[model samples]
Target: MWLTSKIKQLLMVMKPGVVTLNYPAERPPVPKNLRGQPVWDHQKCIGCGGCSDHCPSRCILTRDVCQELRVMLYDGSRCTYCGRCADICPEGAITMSNSFEIACDDKDDITTRLELFMMTCQRCGRCYEMEKSNAIDRINLKGFRYDNLEQRALVRTTSETFSPELLKESDNYKRPSDKE
Candidate 1:
């Protein structure tokens, strides 16, 4: 019975219906749903750090390379291809690509680098923006001009009005103590 079973196994192994491919020579068939690698678009990115926060392996690194510029580094070697980064990006900056061939001698080969310029408030000298984002630019372009002196004065007043001391000084502002 053992000899018959061994013969049957040999026959199955010798069957011509088996499908095989030479992997090194021919690219292996990748599934359509396969999330292979994450690609970063610096132009679309707003330096939000959403990808870094969502990354499971902690492959994304956001560092202040200089006072004027911020750098975001995506280390592919540490990535798990989880696609969380691509999903969580508010600006749609990150995307998953089909290219899985990331083998390299140098670690930086697969790294994606992005730089964002810091925008400072002209009046207050506060670094309000890490990057000159499109949304803010659009707002400014659509009538809200920060370069206008009147607009700047309005912004300053708006910010100062939020302060307790400033609110106390304002005739229109009534604090809880004043109301009591």
Candidate 2:
């Protein structure tokens, strides 16, 4: 009885023989709608900070360097690839590419940085006002942001105008410790 059962098990295993592929040398076809990685189109992006705000993993970050310059950074190391940034983009600037093999030693290899030149109002140092009709544009940060890209930290603080005090505070931001 034991011999018969062993033979049956061997036959069952042999039925689905050699289903594994020779990976690294041979690649399989990518399936449809695979959310592998996020790609950004700098031309289409309006520096609205919408993607940064909507990112579930908080991998996308935005920093207003000055009144006329806004820097956006996307750190793929922390990204969950949920495709929220692509969907929330009003200008269709963000897209999910179908390249899934992203194993890398350096995090900078997957990091994306965008330096956008913004048009500011002469009277007020703020960015050019957007029309109120579009709700997507309204969901962005109104003032200045100072995210720490080197530390990969999102400083959840903003000011109506560029403030050096706020920038200094962000620089000193430290994560809470569990030891306390």
Best-performing candidate as measured by lDDT: 2
Q: In candidate 1, how many Å is residue 49 off?
A: 0.6
Q: Which stretch of 10 consecutive residues in model 2 shows the poorest summed lDDT?
A: 124-133
Best by TM-score: 2
lDDT values for all models: 0.58, 0.83
The stretch of ten residues in a row with the least summed lDDT in candidate 1 is 143-152
Give TM per candidate. Answer: 0.61, 0.83
Q: What TM-score, to 2 decimals, does candidate 1 have?
A: 0.61
Cα lDDT tens digits, model 2, 116-148, are 998765664553344435665455555788998
lDDT of 2: 0.83
Steric clashes per prediction: 0, 0
